[model samples]
Target: MHKVSVIIPVYNVEKYICECLESVMAQTLSTGIECILVDDRGNDASMEAARKCIAGYSGPIKFQLVVRAENGGLSAARNTGINNAKGEYVYFLDSDDIITPDCLNLLVERASEYPDAEIVCGDFQTFPQKDVHKLISLQGKNFPESSFDKSWIRSVFLSSFPVIAWNKLIRTDFIRRNNLYFREGILHEDDHWHAQAYRHVSGLAFVNKVTYLYRMRPGSITMSDGVEERRLENMTLIFSEMFAKEVEWDKPWSDWILKSVGSLRYIGNKANIKEKAEHCVSQLLPTVYKNQSAPFILRLLFKYYFHNGVIFSSRLFYKLYAIYWKYKG
Candidate 1:
């Protein structure tokens, strides 16, 4: 079996696809690696460029060009790639970005060292430009030293570790056994997938090496116009799903307190969405915070701020969470 399957979803990334593929082809640990390129039926020359790049390739790593029947979005494309992937571990590499020659090598090595790790996260650097992007994304970043449980989820909100698929190497069996597939028909699918996948991860390991190079492409979803409302809606959906699952946790407030405030911060004033969030929080608070043995000020924040028609900022949540983390019994 292949040690790693690099899944690259091809969809109108013709200009940068070749560079992305070359980075994989140049892998220092190319043996037992396969690259699966899922063509999501975009009306572009991306596949042609990928074909031309692979035509002359005499590398040990195998390549598969899997074509979809119709044009599906990024989430669907990644699902197809995961379905077709045959490696023990799978790494999603966006066609527009590139990875270091040792990307696979480092990830596989870390996974081997900690065989119980269902997810292994690697650090990254934004390429060519976007130094400011690096600062905002990397500041306060705290990586776990070894495989850990749900407590590690704290990093998602409190730290700079992001929720992007490209930087995470996921174990194939862990994903399938838990039925963790990307939610289809949505932008920012990674945000949804991040929460879903983490819900089942036994533990996550971190390899702090900079293996991936992230490129800030023009016309990306974040830069597109007329999508603010849609973005808010999708984030609300994702956060709500998380909140639902979190309420079932034995100690929901541990993560839920910070996460709930984080949710309100993003899904601000989206028509009647506040009611949905409030309802969820209302059901959770009496059962959770009243019985949850947490810090006094933290519990006070959630209990009052959630129901008193009051809203707060993520910075306040962070400030309080930082204190809670520093003095948790």
Candidate 2:
């Protein structure tokens, strides 16, 4: 067994797979790391590029490739990687992204320090292809370098540290014991799995150093223009499932809703999926309003909408609020 299993889900990332794999090959703690590359039946040369890189790689880490029988999407590809991983900790890496030379070393060091932590997170930086050499810190002021238990899990959820899967090094046993798996065939699968995992984590740790480099490339699923409807539907489904759970109310709930409203408005305006976005807002408003932990302004807005139903419809209000946010930013 290895110390960490870096799972790379390969789709149509032929242009960037070599760089991603090379970063894996250049890990400081290369001896005890296993790189599992899962091919999701992509039509491009991604698999070929991976094979060439792995073939020429002289690193001490173990490398394995799993080819899917058919195209099962990102969730399925990641699930396959998780199922095949033989490491104590699992780290998901996008094929288009790269990690620092000490990424694995830093995460493993933090894990050693916090032996009870089920999840260890490191900061990340995002860059476009042209500016790949530049690094910008995504760490926020509220993110502290400390170890937290389940009691502080909600705070972790509400922190500036992203809820993204790639930024964290998760214990394999914790994920297996909790039966945590990504929802297959969905666009926003990470949100669902992370939401559940956050609730059950026994301990969490943070590494203040930036380790991962997220590439903001065009035509990626999150940045694509044509997938707005599917994205909106997936967002709604995830939030519905999350809100229906009998979890304690907290400020994070309200903050997340408020933050999501901006995305809803963007989807409505860009994708012409206003009806679906409005439906989700209608379903979530009551829950958002009921959470005392939420900001007073958000609750007040919901109350105003409730009392004056005709004057400020959910859709209209979201549109106006999004405008305010745009200008504020």
Candidate 3:
């Protein structure tokens, strides 16, 4: 079986897709790699470019293009890739991003050393399109000091690692057993997926050096106009359903969940969330731990919203909460 399956979702990234695919083809590991390109039926020649890339490639790696009947968005394409990956480990690579030639080589090496690690994350940096090639070709395939001292490894606090899906090599069985599928129809899907996926990790590690190069596109989703409105809307939905999906609450990592739940200090006014959605958030609060270990303000808000709103306590908490927000936010 292949050691790693690199999943790249193709859309209207014709201009950058070639560099992305070429980097995967140039992996220093050479063998035991399969690149799965999911064609999401974009109105462009990205697939045409992919076909040419596969045809011209004279390497040991196997390339497969899965064509979807319709464009189901990034999450859907990612789900399809996860469903079809036939490797021990799977790595998500955005079509607009490029990885160093030794990226997979080094990640596979680290995974081999730490067989129990479910998710091995490699460092990544954002680069302008003009500098992508230079970034990919930068020297230093190995990091002796970073690897030796292990200063690069960090404990995931509430899944705090970047939240981006790319540049992480995840064990296939780990993802499958935990049902870590990306939710479709959500804008910041990573926010929800990252939180869920990290909480289940028995062992997690990181390769500190930058292995992935993210292209800084002008009209990227995060920088697009009217994005803040969409972000707030999706964040509302994320906080609403994140805990209702029945995560195991009695495990050793339960503290993580407690911290996550205790941090919901939103009183329906922060993001101008609709009254109905705010009610949904309030409903979920009671089911959280009786003594939540989440962030301080979220705990305060929990009392303010869940309790009967005693006038004196409410006023006092509001004053403190207001002060906290004024300085912290």
Candidate 4:
């Protein structure tokens, strides 16, 4: 069996797909890697580019292209790739992103060392196409190179480590056995799947190496403008499901909620979506204020805002703070 199955979801990334495929082709452990390309019926020439790259490829890595009949969004495409994966571990990769040559080798090596770890996470860097030289590494000082069992799940979740799916190599059988799948028809599907994995995985390991290079495309859903409403809706649904599952509102959960509120406030202020912002603050502020996991200063700020009926003022304060920091820097 293949050591790792890299699942690349191809949509409208025609311009960047070739580089992504080439990155996979350049993996150090080519013989034990399988690259699964899922074409989600995009109208662009992304599939054509993928086919061309695969056809011209002379690599030892096995490749499979699965073309869906209908366009089912990112979550569905990921599920399709997971369903067809044949490797022991599955790693998600976006069509616009590229991985280092040793990405798979590092992950597989770490997994081999920790045979009981069902999930292994590595660090990553984010870069824009134009500013590729100015890549920003996301390695955290808090995340030591170590293996963690189920007891450390909360600490893992609360650490500076990112919750993104692409940074982790997950055991295929673990995911299937736990019935962990991305939520279909949602934009922020990673949030749910990552939460579930953390909850159910027997153990997880961290590899302190930069393996993945996440490309910050301008038109991507997370970066694009005018998608605030969709983002807010999806995040709300995700949080609601999480709360329903009785996930403790500990420090990590509180931190996530606060960040979510901050994002909603920023988007609302930018787009003048007052009603949505007000509603979200009203629903979330009480829980955020009550949770003791957040920093004392943040909790105090929330308390002041809640008592003073100036919840919206935090947005202005954040903007001014940003400007101050920019000038200071």
RMSD of each: 7.0, 6.4, 7.7, 7.5
User: How well is each residue in 1-329 modelled by candidate 2, as lDDT tens digits?
Assistant: 79899999999999999999999888888578999999999999999989988899776988999989999999999999999999999999999999999999999998998888888888877775543222223444454555564456676564454668886889999889989999898898877787777667767788878799889977789888678888887887787777667777566655665556545655665676666766666665554444333345455456544542433355667864554344343
Top-scoring candidate (lDDT): 2
Poorly placed runs, candidate 4 (over 4 Å): 128-138, 149-151, 247-251, 254-263, 281-309, 313-329
Off by over 4 Å in 2: 129-138, 254-266, 269-273, 283-329
Clashes of 2: 0
State the lDDT of candidate 3 residue by residue for 1-329, as single tens digits: 99999999999988888899999988899889999999999998999988887889889999999998899999999999999899999999999889999899888888888788787778777786434222222234342322322223224324244567788898999989999999998888887887677556666666767799888887677667656556655765775576555655433234444444333333233344434334443455444423233464475465554654432234544554555554455
Q: Which candidate comes out best when scored by TM-score?
A: 2
Candidate number that wins on TM-score, 3 or 4: 4
Candidate 4, residue 123: lDDT: 79
For residues 71-185, write the lDDT of model 4, one tens digit per residue. 9988889889999999999999999999999988888888898878887888777775533222122443555455464446665563444667896889999889989888999
lDDT of prediction 3? 0.70
lDDT (CA) per prediction? 0.72, 0.77, 0.70, 0.74
Better of 1 and 4 by TM-score: 4
- Taking all chains together, each candidate's TM-score versus the true structure is 0.77, 0.82, 0.74, 0.81
- Model 1: residues >4 Å from true position, as ranges? 132-144, 149-161, 250-329
Clashing pairs in 2: none
Which should have the higher lDDT, number 1 or number 3?
1
Candidate 4 pairs with clashing backbones: none
Q: Where does candidate 4 have its weakest 10-residue lDDT segment?
A: 131-140
